[model samples]
Target chain A: MTATQPKPRTSRPGLLGIYRSDLGKKYAMAISGVFLLLFVFAHMVGNLHAFEGPEQINHYGEALRELGEPLLPRTMLLWVGLRIPLAIALAVHVHAAYALTLTNLRARSGSYDGRNYLAAGYASRTMRWTGVITLLFLAWHLADFTWGIKTVNPDYVRGDVYGNLIASLERWPVFALYLMAMGALGLHVWHGAWSLFQSLGINNPRFNAYRRIFAIVFATIVTGGFVTVPIAVQLGIIG
Target chain B: MNLTLRVWRQAGADAPGRFETYPAEGIPPEASFLEMLDIVNERLERNGAEPIAFDHDCREGICGSCGVMIDGVPHGPQLGTATCQLHMRRFDEGDTVVVEPWRAAGFPVVRDLMVDRSAFDRIIEAGGYISVSTGSAPDANEIPVPKDAADAAMDAAACIGCGACVAACPNSAAQLFTAAKLVHLNLLPQGQAERDRRTVAMVDTMESFFGSCTNHGECETACPKGISIDTIALMNRDYLKARLSDRRLLGRS
Candidate 1:
């Protein structure tokens, strides 16, 4: 077989790779898992500045702006460039997850017998649904903040991003949505963090205790950081 | 203790199986679940009936031959014990324990509870071994594996080729079992020579037989040794790296 010739994608036995056959799906998950994990850490750091005063948080955002500084055509294009790939990654991860889930559900049509507790963790079991909700929240969050599309406050400005955030969170429904999205983010991180260690071949039975502990700690930090943003903004603390 | 049992019975591979109810009256509560089945078989034999053909060997739970769904849960309702290791004391008196074989298309039922797990052997044959020739054994400490790597490899090696993961997983994925083999062989220095080839062959074979993982935690939960789902992730990373990094395969004949 020459290098230029396209390699045939062999379909393994058992109906189009339901549950066990698809190799691409597994790596799609792993590679995307790495990217998503990086996004989580970056997002957490950006969110942590909220715990300081409003100026500190806005300064952090400004620092982010400095990375893609020379805004030639549009200032918001910098943010859009960063977000587009993240959105694409999110779309692939969630779409593959949903497709894999549907295939698995069909294959195991006769076998389910209430072995809910037999699964590895609560997070793994609910990964599909949680992924769907997280995607929806991501779209809404982008419109509300990134693109400055829809906000409760019509006076939302482009470069005045921090002020726009403060105004948006002051509304009861917007605050509630932020809280719910953060909770979903917490669930995603709780399992994904430890699983990343496993993917990178860091699993030791002895160190597994450490891995679980770190998972909880990381989950807590991300959850606390994101949740603090909305809560602080809603109150008179951040504005 | 007297208990009711609904067991799946099929005479041959082609025969369709169904649940048959049997009233089992046992005097000992400390007997293993398989021992309880043995007691029921003894009675069947005396009555000029063919014994219930369930798979078991080395009742110590190390052989991985004995596996069954009991009361809708694999290996009964125990947290981390296989059927051979599960005791009768866990069940209440007069309880109805439903028993069934490991049901998956890849594992066809050969007898009553004996499904052909040769698929696992086939997967192994596809490339589950180190290619070290039959030569003199190397020095024990020659291949100095790091403590962490050795520890992790041993943990992965803990898997006993049991179909419990396949049976328990909603997707019937052999990722845990296949991954265990991948991790154990890929982690050691001796196994490093065949590392790239090992991952591609084993994982490709597994993909040919089992379902893809959707991050369901059932396999880890059903595993008697508490093998984590992270093995699947490691296998994924290794396979991807191998696909890109295998230098020998780049310009070879």
Candidate 2:
């Protein structure tokens, strides 16, 4: 056979090019997902300090503002260094999720007439629905606790983290909504943790079992930990 | 065995397509899926109708040319079997199988049950090969590959460019096909020289036309060759490494 001339080398895609693709979006989602996971886990642990008493939990909330005090202005370091990055991660995660969903919708113009999802799990299938729920829940959570929005939390007070949590959870409807959101968070994190490793290219058959266990355990702990707070408050254990 | 086939038909790519039901009678249980289609087509031809235009070559299931959604499952319900290899015995008499083309924006239908998978070809053209100098065969012992690596590479190489992974995926992702190609080459000694370049180019090309892999595992199920999703993980690793390192090689200061 005659030797064919090699084609000219195509210019390498830049970082922007990488982000434009489906794989790049997945990487963005995974990396940002890790950041969000860290924040979620930390938030759950911080909230769990409420079990000790109002003083312990209140101090923990105050410590967040006092982070990096000598080197930086009050609350400046936490807001600038940590919160900003977390916000960026959340933005990227949501953006990528939306873009991927649109692309996926376009890719398959129509569903199968007689379809069966043999291999897909409940968590995998409900990712979009859970994601939307989590987003809405996040907004409500921030409004009620962080921003002290009176409409959502009539008794919300600034800097009084423990009191605010109890006042919000005192309402049965609020407690139920919080519990439902945590359930959605549990499902989201369960699938995200398991699949994030694959997105980051760490999958191996040998470690797959461990991945599954980690996802379930981590999701359960975070969700269960958060759920305990409202239940504790409602039961007057912490209130 | 007698069967009812709701086959999708389209006059052209721009034209609308719809499912047309037809009776497939007196088909032997031993006949392959394509053979059953052949009998149906013969009857349609005798009745002065336009015979179904489907894609098939190498009915032995090696070429990866034949594929259709049977009862909404790519390559039917048989695991790890191609459409051509699926026999009528898998379906019982009086079964109503809904046959449709691989429905994806990237894979447009050319006619009845045949899709234009040239997007896959474009991905291959992007970078699915090594830049080997044309010459006589090199000695087998020149560069010895580990037994496991060779086996793994061969396993990934088993992909026949079939679009079942795309069809089977809800997201219509081509990660399985692209990963198979990338792993088949990247695992080998010859392929190492351009591994980074190949990963970036091929993945970029794939993302242009396909959906993202959400770890749905449907691609592995739809794969006639039973290609593992592990290959996709390997490809992701390589692409990440390539994006970071390949920039330096491009003389970007």
Candidate 3:
């Protein structure tokens, strides 16, 4: 009846409702994927410090560890401030991904009919599994390396973080775990990075080939770079 | 030139589909893709095997009925051209061609290389048309449509509903098809009344049948008409507007 309104009201849900639908879940997953890729770049840069040898790497680690120290003022809490946002971003990213997978599965209603994988690559097809495997690897890495709570070999003490890493890599089982985990990371990065570009509407005919090349180059560098450290340690290339 | 063709063969809708290999002989490089298929089918008929049951109504490319996943690419390696318009010169002599029907859950295989695209029909039925009445045709100049708007409408109308978009999409999403129809119909002044209803009904119907669009540009790449994914964004915008607008004025409930 108001001038702003046109006709009689209906019972249908509003535009907000559309954003809460199944399609909305995908949009959330897409937005959060950007955050996850950012985290990967930061993590990779942190890992690269290992290449600078023990003194540089250990100092960097110690600096990161002191970021949230209680003696520091709120302005000085760089790591703590960043960690909170990163945690939220990671949560939304992982939750949205799982929700989307569940929605896809439910929409199909438990059917395992044949699917075409031609327009997709192996990494793109196995995103869900790769994501899960990477998550599990994260948990193991945090416990073994970050918390210093577990050890495959009791003789390996945790005095030096760098020495601990080398000793852990020397153990076949630990090295195998790291290799498998890095493989998942490689797959995750390959597809996730490409999909992020697509979601943001930046992926077009002109930039598609470049985006693909970047994804491959990034995946190879990160995965290959991380694996080298473990391999070098296992082969006694580093102390 | 001689070429090896692997065409999908199925006896009926319920029957299992399999690839049947055949040799394409004496094919002219200038002939259209469908003509090349016809040559292969002629050889199959002579051998007493059932000719591949692919769909084709207008070989001139207007009808949008003829399509096949050619050698792993929808509508062949050529971009922006339909399968029927694609020339044989694109392929090398003695090359192997793999042809299959449009792969989608909504588009079930009816026979060899023929999928029942009734799902698209159902989506159209859901709300593809305008409710405007016709008497004597109005003068074209009576409506003052801007040049840009008319051009965009034509662009969207260019979608042939060949399901190439669905096949090329990794998610097998039909958003491009649904959005094209919605945008094409809603752009004109006549389609204004039913715009809201059309967007909602068509999008809901599409979701029930086809896979979700993940915004990948693969469909845009495979579309014979080169329908832009921008239509999907338009659909989203209209659907959002429709939610607040009254249903009675919009017509259909």
Candidate 4:
């Protein structure tokens, strides 16, 4: 076993095997989560056009539709750039979460009448619940806005982004739903952003402080940015 | 001091265990938790009943033999102390304490309050040691290890393999335990030779019996040795590095 000439590496697990390993599943979750995080931030930023009034927000929406006109064709960039990659990242993230959750459930400790905790954070403890709520919200978001489903969005008007946002959010129930979903998103992202670093092997005592602050700040900004638009519409400021 | 005790009583590994109530009457508060249990066991035997079974040795706490979930917390509510080191004074006179075994898929109940922790031994056997030819012991300071590295390594080495971490973890993840072992060796110069191999082997072996870590930090909280969760960060990093560097070092994937 001395350190000498290396032997053939025949026993090592291959790429596929590694990917299937628990650590590999963690890597998948972390990497996919990074992409989703980027999308949410970019989304909040893009939606900020609402602050400028209807014309500006509508103009911003059109830009997305015609993002790669001529060079890549209309909506091509939107599909390849935003929609496709986001869907893939979301799928991978959910699959990894589901698989890891199944494993955790079976690796059981026999029941105790009382169980106490010391260090697990509130956000971390509720990750699965928050994640599920966020997923369901995503589905509703796609149906109401992107697909412009008539039943889901009774006032949905094609190509009228400002009108649609105002029409949907003017309803108190929908506004409440949006606020609740954003809250869940904040909890999910707060723990998730911090967790991704550990899963990606980016942990160090140096960055540890910034890691927590960054996750908290990011979660707040994203949630605030999103919840503001619906609130503005409901309060008759934007509408 | 008197207390009501609900002990998990199992006749065998596959036996159905239940909480059997016993009264710790007129016992000394200064008794260690295990000693209190011993007093109760003596009472049960004197009453012509079966004595409760639990593991213990070197009750000063260094042996890593004794552990139990007292009232749902691994190693009880006390911070950074094993069950053997936990004094009975920590509880109130009439407190109702529920005692249970360290439960996990990897740790099967052997009998009342005792679990088979050999899964940890298997993980160690996988690749926990550094390889060197047998000879006269080398000089203590031969390698000139950085003071900070040595300190961190010692902190990791303090883990006595008590399995309290797994018992406390919601996911039953062994990352904290695995990481403690990893940091103990991986930070040393002599450990550099097989650092990657050891990391890969040990982590993989752990995964087979345990759940993936979700960064809950419960393991660190329950660790009797006060082993930091940062050791888990080191294990994750080393495992990833092994996957990359081992390919290049061994030549051809």
DockQ, ranked from best to worst: 2, 4, 1, 3
Winner of 1 and 4 under DockQ: 4
Off by over 4 Å in 2: A1-14, B134-141, B247-253
Candidate 3 ranges beyond 4 A from true positions: A1-21, A45-129, A147-187, A200-239, B1-4, B22-30, B36-49, B89-96, B129-150, B182-200, B214-216, B229-253
Tens digit per residue, CA lDDT, model 2, B105-148: 77877888888888888788878887885345666457789998
Worst 10-residue stretch by lDDT in candidate 1 chain A? A1-10
> Candidate 4: which stretches are off by over 4 Å?
A1-15, B134-138, B247-253
TM-score for each prediction?
A: 0.77, 0.93, 0.72, 0.95
DockQ metric for all predictions:
0.18, 0.43, 0.10, 0.42
On TM-score, the stronger of 2 and 4 is 4
* Cα lDDT, model 3, residue B169: 67
Best by lDDT: 2
lDDT score of residue B226 within candidate 4: 97
CA lDDT of each candidate? Answer: 0.74, 0.88, 0.74, 0.87
Looking at model 4, the pairs that clash are: none
> DockQ (C-alpha) of model 3?
0.10
Can you write out model 3's per-residue Cα lDDT over B1-253, one digit (the tens) per residue? 7789888787986777777788888999999889888888888898897887878888877788998888778888898888999999999998988888877666777888887777788789879986655345676557778887788898999988898887776566788899899889888876887888888788767766666665556788888888887777677667656755767755665
Q: Give lDDT tens digits, candidate 1, residues B1-253.
A: 9998888888998888777888789638999999999999998899998788999898887888899988767777886878999998999999988888887666777877777777688678867887776346666476678998898899999988878888887687788999989888888887888888788777776655566675656788888877877787678778767665655756885
lDDT of 4 by residue, A181-238 (tens): 9999999999999988888778788778898899999999999999989988987989
